[model samples]
Target: MPKWISLDFGAKYKLSRLKLWFRGDLEYKDGNYPTDWDVYGSNDPNPDGSWDSWTFLHHFDEPYKPSGLPHKQYTQEDIDYARSGIDYEFIAIPEAYRFYRIKFNETTGNGAFIIITEMTYWGKLEE
Candidate 1:
């Protein structure tokens, strides 16, 4: 089983950097990955009707070997760590009118699994 992480955006400021790490062994067959995850933000806690569309940030495999990484950039098991490891990062935090939120959707198999590990909010407090 693999692990995932997320961060929350609020009604104070937009995010600039996001760092994430995946723990545990990951296995992929035929080189197919699920498309999930979204960035959201709003003032209300519920944040209903106030969410951005789902987007693709990054994709990795158990071995981290790209079917054809240009220039042979990434190597197999590039992010594989038996004891400790780090996985992904995002530099551009969407220009949220107010805040930012992260939604993870892992809809791939008959069994649906989506988990949130971390959620941090970065911004100025409202007066």
Candidate 2:
């Protein structure tokens, strides 16, 4: 079972990179952030919500972002990184997909909720 957050672009586009910023739990010591998750792409005109339906883009297990450690203390770099956001660029060009989705499988604190400051998709519209 996957809890997919789907996005429809209305048309195909060749994707470039993904930028994300988490600003939900920064106030807390051990804030909530995605520790492990996945990204998927799809051009299926009609998807049926099956594991085999979406295109597996990448399995993100080691995304270097930022963190507070030792005694729930955040560094200057950590603060900046969180505020500026991080980019996850595609190593190679991927096929155009009109629709994209994210399956948020897990998070760092595994708290009751997760907050995202922003989510930006970098790509060029397909002709």
Candidate topping TM-score: 2
- Against the true structure, candidate 1 reaches a TM-score of 0.41
> TM-scores across all candidates?
0.41, 0.76
Cα RMSDs of all predictions?
7.2, 3.3
Candidate 1 lDDT over 48-75, as tens digits, reads: 4323443433342222333444322344
| Alpha carbon deviation, residue 79, candidate 1 (Å) | 2.9
Candidate 2 stretches greater than 4 Å from native: 24-31, 45-47, 65-74
**What digit string (tens of lDDT, one per residue) describes model 2 on residues 1-127?**
2245888889988888888877744732333456567777888835666656678776664346366353345677666776677678776656888878787776655554556778998889995
- The stretch of ten residues in a row with the least summed lDDT in candidate 1 is 26-35
Best by the lDDT measure: 2
TM-score, prediction 2 = 0.76
- Quantify all predictions' global Cα lDDT against the true fold: 0.37, 0.67
